[model samples]
Target chain A: MNRRCSLITILATAAALFTGCEREEIRVYSVAKETAEAPAKAASDTPTPAANAPRPQLAYTLPAGWQDAGPTPMSLANFRITTDAGEASVNITPLASMAGKEALVVNMWREQVGQKPLAEGELAGALAPIEIGGEKGQLFEIAGSRDGQTVRIITAFLHRGGASWFYKLQGADAVLTAQKPVFVEFLKTVRIKEPGSAPAAEVVKVADPAPAATAEFKWKVPEGWQTLPAGQMQVAKFAVPARDGAKAEVFVSVFPSDTGGALANVNRWRRQLGLEAVDEAGLKALVTPLEGAPGAMLVDLKSDAKAMLGAIVPREGRWWFYKLMGDTAAVTAERAAFIRFVQTAP
Target chain B: MKLLWKFFTSLRLTVWTLGFAIALVFLGTLAQVHEGLWDGQTRWFRSYFVLRKAGDVWWVPPVFPGGYFIGAVLLLNLLAAHLKRFQLTWRKAGINLTHFGILLMLVGGLATDMYSRESVMNLREGGTRFFSEATREHELVFIRTLDDAREEVVAIPTALLRTGAEVRDAKLPFPVKVKSYWVNSTPDFRAPMGKNAAPLSDKGIAKDWDFSERPETKGMDDRNLPTAILDLGEHGVWVVPSWASDELLIESVKRTYTKSVGAETAAGMAAKMAAPQEVEAGGRKWRMTLRPTRHYNSFSLTLLKTTHEIYLGTSTSTNPQGIPKNFQSRVRINNPTKGETREVDIYMNNPLRYEGLTFFQATMGRDEIVDVGRSGLQVVRNPSWLVPYLSCLLVGIGLTVQFLYHLIGFITKRRATVAV
Candidate 1:
């Protein structure tokens, strides 16, 4: 009896072990609630013309005798200039960044004009510095033959509002030469508006209820501040009255944690103020600790005309943006108030 | 016990199982021409019993013997042979080690086959992603944008969606009823007053274009563009894969409308006012679309840039016959929970392994349009990935020791013969 029992027990244990090593169970994942958010739209997906749409008045004015041909997919503004010799076309394109070296762009134009690309040493002689919209820019003029007709292209490159703008006028040599002076006058009329001024459509009063108690932090609003309806991509908006009757705005927004991180957000704010982008080390120099909120950072950036006081607070897998931006004097006056509001959050 | 031992340790059984496995692999490779790699793998290599479809009909009687059966028999034979014949003698030690290594490799393969998951992460330049999506399967996603910058997403796997199937979940505010579903389809457009023309849905961007189901394609590069007509009661919308973006659909609608009206109006202005496919329920707005099912990770990867180098003297991309010199992705891995941030370059043959997941640079292409670089990384997770390495080491060591032992014995015998 003992021998039989031992044999049966050994077989049972072996069988059990083999069965225990069966295939892994198919995983059934439940929905994860209140986690990190979806990513923001890609930088490339942000249309260049739409980026300038919020400040349409900042665009260049059409020269006299130039008919507006409207915007194209790649160009923000398109116009047709009619002359006795022939008709010329003008395209104003604003891009998020310079995609390549200046030489590559010049070569691309040369190729379009049916002319050979200039060598490295020849590039210096081909480009000349010119002033457009109160900013120094590069100008290039190339003449070539296309379809047995003399064609000319006059191109200008300008940097403004943290973006690269290209203005090109291409047509018959006679027409392009005649329209060159008018194009220069058109470039001078370009206006880059100060950041933080509300778009004309958004200047109307919009009633927005205060935030609910679902948030972990609460704050007390200062006097003479009116809450406006929070638009898309914004959590809250507050209008602060200025002595000159123009209002400086304080707004709150939030994004997924590390959604471009602190440096990218700071550079985006600087871009809004028409300032140059900074490197990581420069970002650190611009950031300071918020007085009461541990692990929170405050960034103060200013251009010649506009300034921004912003705070970035990381919490619960989300990053919050609290900013007050407007005229230099207005932003400076509200800097302490913005800091106090952020510090008083509980 | 003796009878069981004899059956398990039989050399005939091992030979039979192995031979059947070889035949099955041969037949599976031939089947891949008709069925794609994914379907062929699931039907042949992954299943316990291989079902032979009758005349291309799936719902027919099946024939016998699959990969799982052969593998199981082989495993049993190996274990039983070891138990019956294994001894601790020095002469048999090498054989024992070799057999053990082989057994480990078989088990490891089984584990990997059962548990491994593969997905792809696609990123545009300067884009970041926290999840990877399965290349073969798709899901219908309902996204609700919350005020706190977070999104509440309810995903339904494509396998569960069929014609006339009602999908209801506690997490969803409203039940979605699928009216029609097609694995592959093409949009059929006609004049508004054409014969046999179907009415358009009031919601989706392609409201004017009718849909016609097409047979699933078997070409290697062809992808199944699934489309479905779903009813949310008061609203109805059409759902297609991510390749069919809202803008593309709106453009198609505008083109078809212009053709019908025989006018060349500015379609761009009309496209701007196109209504998006959105549904309102439970005091919130939800955007519904069909996308690949995503596998979220705790960490996030940001693609700093992707570079694709071509061969010299070629204006186009690298020649199809010749490999590119270099295709690389510079990515930054950030794990806030662990407080770790590092930049790693992933390129051909060199993969980044982190948290048991291996990321391989799979392909490089443009991001929807030319001039924007996009990188595709293949992410694989297999808990048994280390098994093959260990098995190879053990097998090599055992074979070396066995060879040396025989060589020494031969030398001793030769010397003794010379003395004699």
Candidate 2:
């Protein structure tokens, strides 16, 4: 139930990212022979609607001599499409990337046209609205006569999730227009396996939180000092010890669950010692084993947030950590109590 | 007489002058939309010489504009008589700061106008500059190239050059015959020709001249003087000469490679070729350059990078268009004898100041390609910058005292009113 709840929350956030903000990207799935050559065929029994049979989920005609580009795990699909029409390239982005407004789609067009993203009225001439694949999307086109050369570019949006697939066609006016009928035909070809019946994503099991360690230490508090709960980014705050102001805090939060993982966490801390940015693996390289937890690793660092020390322990299926560290001076004075806090916390 | 003096020393002059100054600036700014920024000065700038010397009344104000000589005198006069107004308290000191800042700014303008020297120093990368020549907004130079001499520089007045195709200027090394003149310009290879060509009837500034192009070189060959590009027709036919000037001096060097008598090897160096450009008008030539106003310098700059960042997908401050988020350049500095060179890593907000030349990362542009790879640097050298600072300080002090005096007076008056 907990796992399901987590998945649902992630899904909700991803959905809101699209439906809530100024996002205009449309995810376009293409079976063109040009790229991402999946088993899907354009010549399949998928029939063209009679005038208007309420439109297909997604459909588009693959121009001649185009093959799938390659596997793109991050994209809406594993591959892409290409055409002879002035090297028109098409990629279907996933809905997770776009925040879900049509302007973002036009903004993407602005990027290509060498212009700043236009506000609604700014690109009224360029971005025309249209519906494709049963979902509303935007249409964008640009043209100019420069140095005696006339050219035109066109792009259509196919939005879903927090992402948009932009079907861009650019070239000489004649060249781009020649490919238009075929491009729209390709738009008609978009389809996914039944809605809500999507395949379950691969999952890795996670273990429960571990028992705390008993450290030997204590701290002196002022006669009456009130402590408050942190509202956001709690882990980033670490209390400072008394001296000048003598007021401080130390907090922690872990993600991807491996006690937030040991070796990587430890090395990340060491990076604060006049080191350079590193990858997770490099972080793992700087680990020292913990006496109580054999497979555990530990490290320390000082970043923009200040002094930090953390440890990583392997949990059920991932890594977890009981990391504790904060401001240099403040953490130094309260290190014993912090160790005590971590030892007794959930 | 004392009452008249009081009236003359009142805030009326200050207010009027401030309003006129703002209006002039506003008009100048609005005119820039079409006249172009470089051309903006023409619409509002009625140079004293143009009005006073030329006796042009429309541009001249019969009244007064409170510039340094006018505004300062009135202000100082008022300051002398208005001494009792300020009670001289610390509380009023803060208000005085604001006025002092303004005064300092005014004084600074006067100092700058009298002593500052603004000039153009075009240097290619890897070059250095020593002395820079100050320029006027619009002046003409007759590019005089003698049959035997290297090159002779002659200044021409633009007004005369603008009249007819055949302007007969006496200063030309070879009787300066206006072959063509253009106020604004674009390329027109369409000139009819044997050796010279005919000028086209273009309506705009770029259209006003006979257009022709030579190979785009980085040296004198490309530096053009402000011209009234004329059509000096032959006989009854006005012949617009289709030619280009390098604005350079080409002197021959004695060379061992000379194969014949009188055959010369010109010491064709860019620096040697560099000559002052002139404007020809009303049978006279005038050498000209623009003023180095505020931060604008005649030198060219290029931005190395402009990137925008976002935080947690909430707000993005990207340089969506290419206006530039920062200024960076590999500037080509040049001095008359010191030569040309560059200083890299001059970034935005951080300006490079050397000699009397200061280059600020003002904006960006490209030489030819639209929407890419160009930079603008505002170079300034005003002698009176310090004056404004001092003026501001004094005004601040005065305002501070005056404010406290008024506060006390207000309290006393309130008490009296209540008592009554």
Candidate 3:
């Protein structure tokens, strides 16, 4: 069991960590203070740029055959924007569907980052998006190094009415790390469209289970004993008639089959009481009720194993048992009366 | 003088100290009903506090028995009494063994305090490790030098610096101050943030104050508290943000007028306006960055992989989540001193210790868009932590032996009765 438990834990961890194979923080720490976007080039070394680079051209090549997935999200939708050394991407997820900055969102990110949730006084950063790659997107930036690296995440959100998209980019600020451009390229593929405007996914319907055709009826039994119908969790009951307002109840789990039936049952009851515990052979040698009116057998036993006796009736497959147990003297006096009651349990 | 031993080792003293210790813990637990170990806990208990108003105000963690303090006292008493009483017994060997165990525990605690490098090692999937870093323990302090009084005078509210702004605290004579801070400061990098109010440059200070005046304190960036914005020219802008202005804080040439926590304008789901900001004094500050420390060179670690485990078949309605198991972050360690780099695996409860520092696996996070992983670790540098481990082992062994002795005695008595 312990091994199985550990196996499950290992599987769960693997499933969680393997989501996106081994993620690492890429950070480049420099003493220089300015966020100074590295000079667009090593040269023009002297030539100062004219106000802005000619209409901000896309410096990196787009992946071949990469088509737009959707359009920018509608305004008022929660969005995120990420800017890296290369390009940038944006994602928008509808606040309505996601339940708006819910606890799950943080948890999901925590998992992605291979971290637990933020401890108290640890979540220190900014909200709202700044423009990345000339496109406006929500930007969530955290400026603290965790472990031994500085991790900054900028999330841009774009929300349409019912749905939303989010673009998240995080990594160590490295002068040279692989994630920088990959993140930017990842953002380029994201686009949103009108819901349902796209072809609807095929829907499959499943048939519902047939309802139970249950019927209710009333029956009178020995005074102080109650008869529960078949539909109730309690199938049938036969009480040892009330004496001075105090009664002991015997419950029965009834079935309709008799194969490997009643003979197997009487001994099962005796075995349960742990009072010398008889076997089917011993049961045959003892009690007298089996000339085939559904094979009945009875043996005197203690009340301590009552639950076990009640359990046996459910067994015997379809063979129902009219088992009764109570204060010995009380039961002995009422035995014949209870036996007649079981015959009508239906 | 003999009475002194009675005083220190007196039963009355022991009982009083013991009772007080026990009471202290209970009261501390109760006080936690009002205040807790952290401001978040304190804030969490705030509304539910059925206690008095002054409860939180005068809150201090209870100094009860730990494996160290009370353990020491108990051991000292045991040692003295045993030496005097059992010195004549042939069972002195047994008693010696017991006392040795206890002494070991006390010595162990001291060793732990001095030498033990107990730290947490948290690693997700693929995380790196550095040899000189240990996982465990943290400090809350602002870096600063002593003031004119020759005493450690790093005053707060000044300890609270606004983002992109330096913290300014005042001293009666000459104010001692430290600049630059971060809320969730890491081993590297700090993001700049400030209040919604105007920059401190608009309020006071010299216009030419030059420095990366951001994140100079723990959670000290962008004035979340309210304040009189000091527009000190180049000194940058500073606004005492937050709702409350406990007092006018003047440190050095920087003067920031702060108020109490005022409004709730966060994203509603925000826990509260802010955490509890206390007016503290005498707190020490040492730069504890993952970068090049005052002595050690800046080394880097790479995340190999971070793996996690969870308890099975149970969700929120069923079972509580289990601890992360086998948190192994394979790290490539680089030593600037030796000019050598080594790769080692770091996991929970296990760390890579070298030089004076130790590193433990702490936590892990992912960068989905960035395509990478991040792992947190606790770094420590205590020199003598093993003594406690040895002492504890001895003590535990002695206790087990003693308990079994009595247990066997009982069993023999029962057997004798049956035979009779």
TM match of model 2 to true structure: 0.32
lDDT of 2 by residue, A1-346 (tens): 2434433443453343223322212111111111211222121122312211221122232333233453222123222223333344344433223334556555644554455777887766766776665566677776543334454556677555533455555555554654566556555555533234554332222222212112122433323323444322122233445545534454444333542234434554566444576676766565556545546555656655456556564534444444445446654565555544444323
- Give the alpha carbon lDDT tens digit for every residue of A4-28 in model 1: 4444544664564345444311123
* Residue-level lDDT tens digits of model 3 in B4-35: 44544466655765675575456545554434
Model 2: CAPRI class: incorrect
Compared with the true structure, what per-residue lDDT tens digits does model 3 show for residues A296-345? 54444555524222223222334455556655555655666665554443
Model 1, docking class: incorrect
Q: TM for chain B in all models?
A: 0.83, 0.48, 0.49
| DockQ for all candidate structures vs. native | 0.01, 0.00, 0.00
Per-candidate Cα lDDT values, in order, are: 0.69, 0.42, 0.39
| Tens-digit lDDT string for candidate 1 (B125-219) | 77777888887667787777755656777788777678898888876778788887788777543221122133446455454345667897766
Model 1 ranges off by over 4 Å: A1-346, B1-5, B56-62, B188-196, B231-276, B314-323, B413-420
Considering only N, C-alpha and C atoms within 3 Å, which residue pairs clash in candidate 1? none
